[model samples]
Target: MSTGVWIDQIGIDLDAGTQQVDEAIVVMHSAFVEYGHQGQASGAMVETADSLRAELSTGTRLGLARIGGQAVAMVKYRTADGGTLYFGRLAVSPEARGRGLASALVRALRGAARDMGLGGLSCSVRAAETRNIMIYEHLGMAIIGREDRRSLTGAVIPVVLMRDV
Candidate 1:
């Protein structure tokens, strides 16, 4: 049986295919670069193909959306505390951001998480990235708390944790 479905023409795969995972990595790296994010600067943000392979092997559920031979958006999810599903590493290609791909990915996760018998989806976004914060808020996520994340460069990253409202 297929474990994924197309939502808004986006491929939302929980049991990811090999090429889907590879394309996810490519999309993630490209999106991170476009956002001026340095993958090596943060241990939490290991944005490389090998890193993605390692994470995928460790039980991360990969979800991806592709168009015209390449991934355009993606996200990762795993079981977390209190029976919640923790999701992160959400990335959308620069050219695809405003086309509602990110929101579609989030909605897809809601369905996926519920289907897995999980409570809800949890995620964190940089506190300083207000644009992202607003987007999450617009998507029905409520800011729950703040966390200081450690990076490889000794930078204390402030992030806001959010959950489905």
Candidate 2:
């Protein structure tokens, strides 16, 4: 099926771990360049991916969203303290934006979390990612915390807002 027609049609699986990690890095690199070009910074992107891959490699769950049998979007979540789902590395290609793919993927994440007996979902994003922050907000995610001037890779990163689903 074409991508548009597959909007919000997501499937979850416990497999595909290694490939997902590989794909996450690829998509993240592209997204980093895109988001960074808009001023989010390249170092932040690399550090974020490295940190995520390290954790996701073990005890992490993945959700893949496909179009025409090609993987187009992905969501990764880790079991956190109190059994909360700590969501991460949600990336959709720039060409795939505005398709409601990200929202659909999050819904899939919540469903998977619920199946695992998790209470809710949570995630952190760059505070300056206003577009992403707004999208998450519109999807019913509420900001619960924020960090300012945090340094990573020897450079200061601003505003990491935590959200709950």
Q: Pick the candidate with the highest lDDT.
A: 1
Question: Cα lDDT for residue 71, model 1?
Answer: 75
Write down the lDDT that model 1 would get: 0.75
lDDT of 2 by residue, 111-151 (tens): 66677788767888777778888888887788887875644
What would the TM-score be for candidate 2 when compared with the true structure? 0.77
Hey, what RMSD does candidate 2 come out at?
Answer: 4.6
Which predicted model would earn the best TM-score?
1
Worst 10 residues of 1 by lDDT: 35-44
The residue pairs found clashing in candidate 2 are none
Off by over 4 Å in 2: 1-15, 39-54, 149-152
Per-model TM values vs. the true structure: 0.85, 0.77
Question: What tens-digit string does per-residue lDDT give for candidate 1 at 1-165?
Answer: 246667666665666645566678777766766433543344434656677777778887787876654578888888887677888888888888887888887777877778889887889987877988898899889999999987644677889999987
lDDT of 2: 0.65
